[model samples]
Target: MSTVKDVSKDSLHSTEKVADTDSSGTSSIHGAEAAVFEKRVWWKLDLSVLGVITMFYLLSWLDRTNLGNARVAGLQKDLKLTNDQYSIALTVTFVPYIIAELPSNLLLKVVGPDRLLPTLLTLWGIVTTLQGVIHNYAGLLACRFFLGLLEGGVLPGLVLYLSLFYPREHLQKRVSAVFASSSLAGAFSGLLAAGIMEMSGKGGRPGWAWIFILEGLFTVIFGVFTFFVLPSSPSRCSLLSEKEKEYVIQRLREDGAISKDDRADAFSWGEVLRAFQLPQVWFSLFIFFFHGTILYSLSYFAPSIIQGLGYTANQAQLMSVPPYAAAFVCTLVLSYIADKYHCRGAVVMFCGTCCVVGFAMFLSSHNHAVQYGSLFLTLSGINTGAPTITTWTANNTAPHVRRASAIAVVCMFTNIGGILSTWLLGSLSAPPRYTKATAVLLAFAVGLTLFAAINTAYLYYQNKKKAEIRATITKEDEPAGLGDRSAWFEYIL
Candidate 1:
């Protein structure tokens, strides 16, 4: 039997070996030297990568959800769209969106995110800008479908991309930074919509036209900038010194981070299938699916919901700002806490409970103040829950290809909720009060809370079982592979 001291010494020696190994599996940098480089350079690397990706996601989300703002700014009135036709337009976006996610993520691996993401952004920007010129319902439908097709890969692609740069324990805060951009975009879209709608009849175009044109143009410009600024991978980054790059790679290896394999490895269908076999993947899918239904419905309908409460269009747009802003702040704080504690399941459950409570309040109340206050709870809950689930899923998956496939699968299923939300919230049958929609939202929230609780318990059970297995293993019997399935690679609960 190995003594505790012997196990501790072996662990220290193993960690040292991990820090020194180079791409060819020979010792290069001293462990202390690599540690110093990491301590000094990690922040600079994180800032550059996180800043650009956050901005990209912000614009992507703004273009994707800005239709809600446009609707309140007279898109339906200008296009002579009935409520069902408008809902159909929204639903159409998710068809191509869902279909494109897995393929685009696979392509992202083959081509590289720096190349593929920017190209997708540019094409979607053009499509979004063209939405401004649509004369009738069919044109709107066509633009929205293509827009979804082009935009589908971005969020999932970025999630996979970030996994390359950061370790599991450090991921949620960074992922939250990207996800929070959506909330910030939500807030900015409201304020921008109010200002842009003031340009009604400018250049012989309606205010909603200006909203799409101007925002889409902004996305195009930023997409161009991103092509130049974003680095493809830590090993290939021009911004880092050779030593810094090596240190980054070494730290990731020690942390059992994703994609430790050389990028030259052939695409493995076996690995892709293995990703689908993980229970975590399906759990993550359900979590995102339920949360997304509530999240998208709120994003698409909040302004109208507020307007139905007796505010003018501009007032409703402005009022929409607070809920999103509240969500933005809460997402960042909750993600930071989750990462610090290494407790994603707990954070997700808490957020789901908030969603359940918030929606229940909205369903039961008639007072505008109480209802509006409930929006804060709903947005904050759903927004925080999203990144927690995403990061948790990403953290558990490994090898670049498998992570890509898992993320795509998770995102593909989640967007199905986007389609469902359009009809559920945008139905002509539930105007003014939208009582039916609110009730459905409440049911989804309850489901989310239940799902999260069950997931947490299962994770705990898995962890306990893994602990028992680890206790029986001697150093000589340890697995050679890295990542979550390895005997030493415990899942972050």
Candidate 2:
């Protein structure tokens, strides 16, 4: 098999554009040789790039969702917080988290992910550890707000980060891999919280406090380590030889859109505005908003829901593990299928259906075991659909800054749902089941199902109308003001 080193520099840097501008941009670089070299590059990235992104996401999710675990571990009781106050604490985190995401993503290219991602992780880790030591509601709100501010950039930053290395078609699975960490985060928090609870009376702190301290400290340490190891970009990754680096850069050029090295284009307010103009961006925002309502509810309330199952606090912590565990696996599988089929909406809608069915069961059934069982489906669906929504938006938006703005906007809507869930649904009494909250989440699920199909059809139309225009376009025309709307590009259908 031909290797990356064997490819001539002339072929690697070929000026000739491929006849088919829709795919890779390299005209002379094709067939078994290029294919073999590309796989070698991907395998390296799977280790150095995809692996780190996934690990960082895992740490982030643990810190973000551990609030649910801590709640059951007695955070509220120790703080002497009322339901409204506790909800306020939850709601505060998302406020800064939502508002700052756009600017955060825009800064990713300027600041670079290697520095920006790890810096955010370390700061948030410090904040998370502070959650362990707080004595009053004011302290709690401070920690939560800063935590959100630091963390707001992470998910969108990471999603934007992936587009730097991989082609658009390969995005759904990679995005899924990172988000699956959130499901794993849910499971790990429960198991870790269960163990941390054993340290309850030790160090004169409760189990909930220990949960934050230990998890946060570990994150700080890992964040420091990641800074030295995480590669900056395909262009700067030290693992690749010069030829391999060129191959990697050439790969992105072939896929179209501003490759990492070519991102020197001056940022434009007009390009940023375009992200808001696209109908698909609105569809993606709504999908994220509606889908996030149920997901955030599950992340924040799963332990409480399990506790409502007549289980002890410890048992509730342990039981919350299963639904997230199921979600972790299903997220990987479903997104892989979605990427492979290039039919992302089918998988998204199917997952949304899982949520609708799960929520329907929650509202209709009075049985505790059945309600608990429905959580597996509920969480799995919610987690499964998240990455698809992200990739759908990222795939269509272009040039670095615009995609950044679009992704950040999508994240804002996700947290808007979080605020709604925390303030409205979570404040309700849980005695006999939260019939009202379940009904509301069910409506959001139905909305997700309908809109995934709508966005899919709409993208199909956009691609069809653009196909003929695309056929007449060349590589030189791509950098014009049209951005991703440049005929050199087509929306993923």
**lDDT of all predictions:** 0.83, 0.83
Q: Give per-residue CA lDDT, model 2, range 313-410, as digits (tens).
A: 99999998999999999999988887776778888899999999999998899999899989989999999888888887888887777888899999
RMSD of 1: 4.7
The segments of candidate 1 whose C-alpha lies over 4 angstroms from its true place after superposition are 1-39, 259-266, 474-483
For residues 437-492, write the lDDT of model 1, one tens digit per residue: 88888888877777777777777777788788889986458754334666666677
The lDDT leader among the candidates is 2
lDDT score at residue 191, model 2, on the 0-100 scale? 93
Q: Give the TM-score of candidate 2.
A: 0.92
Q: In candidate 2, which residue pairs get closer than 3 Å at backbone N, Cα or C atoms, i.e. clash?
A: 24-254, 25-254
